[model samples]
Target: MKKKILVSACLLGHKVRYDNGNVTCNDPRFLKWSEEGRFVYICPEVAGGLPTPRPDSQIRGKRVVTGAGDDVTKEYEKGAQAALKLAKDNNVALAIMKQDSPSCGSLYVYDGTFTDTKKLGEGRAVALLRQNGIKVFGEDQLDDVEKELKKINIL
Candidate 1:
């Protein structure tokens, strides 16, 4: 009877980051969610047709690009679009994405200036979901996500 919650795979220690690195954390909330089978992990960057250990991408003036002179905004957009399909297919009601990431950042993405300054930007996946009326939030807003999840009853 657990409702599905979409989470960024990297946050759960998945080796799907742009550099093929994992952001392993001992977050009790995620651990509990995983144990309860409530977490549906995803990596939009990888899913969008980018390989692991790919170029480091950033959002510059609303476009996605990498440091290696590779412009992958279209790829990121495609990936984000794909993530939405997955979310919809899974009946996901809540999402917990990584903060400040080009792929998973739901709130406060980089300003694209590459000066380590972030300016309230939305990742491709987050933007698409919100546009489709799906509730998206960052990990810091787990309370809100959990609250919404609890409001739904499955089986």
Candidate 2:
């Protein structure tokens, strides 16, 4: 069986973002992985029951708040848990996610001010995946993903 790697659905060209669009990465490695049936696509925010074309959100001191000031922390946490469960069930050890997303960002995210400022932090799902020993990378970090896969003899 091929080794499984989790990926945010939007990166795989799924229209799962809050704006109902995708952050697709047409990297050859990801294409090869998809052809090998090694990609496990997930949209945690949707899994947590948030609607698409929803409000833009950011992490604020352990809370996830939208641009309109509605708290969505519970949904984010729920989505993280669901995504983690999927990874565990599939025995996935790696993830490539959308950067700067409130639910999937593996690096910097908005600073919760709706001011377009960024701060270094992992998104909720990324943090949970890391906590459970999953190696998470941003969509732009495919080189790192390839290195890790080679290190583990998965490529």
Candidate 3:
């Protein structure tokens, strides 16, 4: 049996982003994985009850806040927990998430100013997943995904 992997819903062409848009990838491997039913999709923000076209949020001093300065740390934390539950329930070992998102970003995210200045840090969901031993990757790190899969005898 193939290993199950958690993937961002937007990366699979689902319109679950804060701006109500999807960040679909056109990679053959992604397509193949989808076809093979190895991908389990989830939108952490949406799962947390946030609506699409919602305000952009960023992490500020360990709290998640919206662009308009509304505190949404509870929602972000809820979403992260939901995502982690899904991963654990599905026995998912790998996660491919959207970069720069407050919930799913695995590498870097925008600073609280939202002026496009990125900071090196993992998002809430990514950090939680990592803490629970789930390997996480950003959308831009397909090469690293392949390497990790090979290392674990899944490639």
Q: Which of the numbered candidates is closest to the native, going by highest TM-score?
A: 2
lDDT of each: 0.81, 0.91, 0.89
Residues 55-139 of candidate 3 have per-residue lDDT tens digits of: 9899888899998999999888899999999998888969999999998999898888888899999899999999999999997
Error of 1 at 33 (Å): 1.1
Across 56-149, the per-residue lDDT of candidate 1 in tens digits comes to 7888876898876578998899889888888887878778888888877887888776677888878888888889987888878777765776
Which ranges in model 1 have alpha carbons more than 4 Å from their true place? Answer: 152-155
Error of 3 at 101 (Å): 0.6
Please, what are the lDDT tens digits per residue for candidate 2 over residues 8-84?
Answer: 99988888899998578888888989888998989999999898878989999889999898999999999999999
Work out candidate 3's RMSD over C-alphas.
1.1
- Which candidate leads the pack in lDDT? 2
Candidate 3 off by > 4 Å: none
